[model samples]
Target: MDNLSNYFGQNINQKRIVVTGGTTGIGKAIAKLLVSLGGRVFVFGRDENDLNGALEVIKAKSFSGEILGISADITQKDDIDLIWNKVDNAFGGIDILVNNAALPARGIIEGNYEDWKYILETNVLGYIAFAKEAVNRMKVQKSGHIINIGSMSAEVKEKTGVIYVSTKTAIRGFSTALRKEINPLGIKVSHIEPGAVTSDMQEDSKEVQKEKIVSMEMLEAEDIAMSVLFCLSQPKRCDVVSMQIRPHLQII
Candidate 1:
């Protein structure tokens, strides 16, 4: 008999996915990859211009699956609710939730409290809030996948900035506990940690250093996309809890 699962194909093709911060950087890259693989993706962000620009890029990539643009800050519950409501009404339930939204880097002791708060709220709260909502929906459907974008900084502490590292570390813990809580219920939670990818967030003064990493080699956004795809593409009977990506040049 034909069913909702059948439509999604063997590896979650028709599955509905929500990608936060899906306008640029890693998020945009992931959204594009997922759509190309036949999964429907709804991108959420705060800037209309950036969102529309990303929409154009994704469209130009020839994504036949549903591509939606939602202009809403992940920090706000109302905005999150609106996006989820649209997804629920349109796709009934989400099969994948990629919490890829994160605030730009900021200093630890030198940075303002506001900056720190923003990072925590968006990087941590935003991901958790969406996961909470997605879990509720998935609970009813009896299955779902939650993939959080983590940083290598989570494991390697650096003098560069502690705020970002702290929150990412929290995510590592969160993903583990969240998985244990929901695994029995059939939901899968995975964390993807990438080391030093070329992104807008890379420091300008350290461009040469980033270039070395990019050259001697850091993982491309698509590499991370593939890592994420691997976690999602696992057989329904299998579960991959966590995996980290490190370039050959990277020591830690």
Candidate 2:
């Protein structure tokens, strides 16, 4: 049976999943999809209040899957350890790792040193750190999947999105290499590149992000979230090397 839960999930019941930046926008959307499909999912957020609020809503659904939240800034190395600890105890082992946490992107021209550092810490290093952590457990289990949420900007340069584009480009390179390194060990790494998704990556107020959604014809967060599910649901013998989703009429 080709289980189809709207591409978000179907046969993924009880699969352990960890999604970073899952408090809102794309990450939250992914978490919700997983919950409805009966996957045990854990997510990280910097704000405890936001995290709790999202968790409450997810739990209220009371689906077969579990949805838990951890409050931490993924940019900090120490916090990654805390997250891992939760995962170790909460689910015992991780079957899927979604490196979805990222800092907002903006123009770069004599940018502030501190801002650049923050972006790099979260967008670049954090991704590698999580994979490293997951590998320790996944190798023992002999099977796992790492899905990196990248952007189409990695392939096409966009105006004023240089820094963000560069980081995603780095992810593209890193994911390809990481796959080669870990595939032999029974782990799968995939890069889900998206174009012009309606996400709050611009650091706007949540209210504003929501208001804009009513008018925009761009891809919804669910669009990207579904791709993630598709990758995870594939047959072990079939490796989806890469999947890119672009909203209609989006040039870049």
Candidate 3:
């Protein structure tokens, strides 16, 4: 894809955006891409060090848009407030909200309860809190776009464990319901499912490569980031709704 042109050809610039877990992996890629396209990006993450490192990268890129890093744990209410308050005060309001933080579950039914709790809090509850807040903020402004980063595992239930599968499925439904309710308010909601991306979330395993079921290209974080930019570029009247992205090599 060609480089994204700025909002008004005034360098890469757009309205303010808030992205959770924007310090690393897919979230980081999305943040970088958005900044590249001239959008001010406010990133919230739990680790200050990681956030600073990410900040360095964005600075190195010399992104025309501003990038703010707020260290906040999404699971904690106080942290959430601090980040959102900063965002609200800085931008007045956000034009886009991307919920991309999540815990990866990779065990069988016999996995420990800790795994389940951690995943649920991060993947399900955290997303809900962020979504609720985003809705409230957007409602006041009378417009906004929300893009939730889901997973392909939501559709192929049998492939993943209980916690991961359940949260993804629930989020898909959440997006649909939220969209239905907010469409009248002109707040667009969308869920994007990405498959087989090379990121820290799947760093522990080479399972997909070992399987060797297909020879097509594996997805890159940039690909997912580009998809996000596409959704944002759409006219307010047209919502992309839901997008499921998978590597051509993988059938499941």
Candidate 4:
């Protein structure tokens, strides 16, 4: 008669989650889906207008779950502090943290020092900082999940976007090591690496993205969101360490 014995495993209802970069693209898709499934979702992005708009859209379809959003830059420590303060006030405690905020990068030689610095702060430091905050609270609770959105470019190592590839590779290493360090505390860490997802980061237009999806050259943002759901829905005894998802025809 135990609900946890169900084949689908844990229920998402009422779980408090924090999703960074949730204003658009993959993060937004994830926020929407998690809210629909009855998880209280707190999302944040750098743009105020976009954050407000996304909150509206997410709230429109939300039935039982709650959705809140804020305008903050992940790269700034003060902003990150403010975000956690708001989260603590809103949800009391967090059950999940989705580190999805990141900037698209240019090749190593294509940008100036400032540009490179900005990307590194936003993409790498931001993730670690947020995870630290989540870990502090989760450690006390002794139960939580951290889901990092990585990219297949980590392995592909394509020459076009060296900086991005490097950041993703770091994420790959971070996720693995973190899981080893924290799993004994009853916390789960999962890394999801996706290939060629259609999002605001892509140069393709919506029409082009749809065409590419049909051709099996691109995947929808929602596809990655579903993978996250799969990881979260698993039994407490099981941990989904890492997952790599790609389009059927995507080659490197």
**Predicted structure with the largest TM-score when compared to the true one:** 4
Q: What is the model-wide C-alpha lDDT for candidate 1?
A: 0.84
Ten contiguous residues with the weakest lDDT in model 1: 1-10
- lDDT rank order: 4, 2, 1, 3
Q: Rank all candidate structures by their TM-score, best first, as comma-separated numbers.
A: 4, 2, 1, 3
Taking every candidate in turn, the Cα RMSD to the unseen true structure, in Å, is: 3.8, 2.3, 3.3, 2.0
Lowest-sum lDDT 10-residue window in model 2: 2-11
Instruction: Give the per-residue lDDT of model 2 (tens digit) for 134-167.
Output: 9999999899999999988888878788888889
Whole-model Cα lDDT per candidate? 0.84, 0.86, 0.83, 0.91
Candidate 1, number of clashes: 0
Better of 1 and 3 by TM-score: 1
TM-score of every candidate relative to the true structure: 0.91, 0.91, 0.89, 0.96
* Model 3: lDDT of residue 20: 91
State the lDDT of candidate 3 residue by residue for 139-249, as single tens digits. 887898899999988998855566788899989998999899988887999899998787777753566643432455467788899888878777666789999888887
User: What pairs collide in candidate 2?
Assistant: none
- In TM-score terms, candidate 3 sits at 0.89
Candidate 2 ranges beyond 4 A from true positions: 1-11, 203-217
For model 3, the superposed segments whose C-alpha errors exceed 4 Å read 1-12, 203-217
**Alpha-carbon error at 33 in model 3, in Å?**
0.7
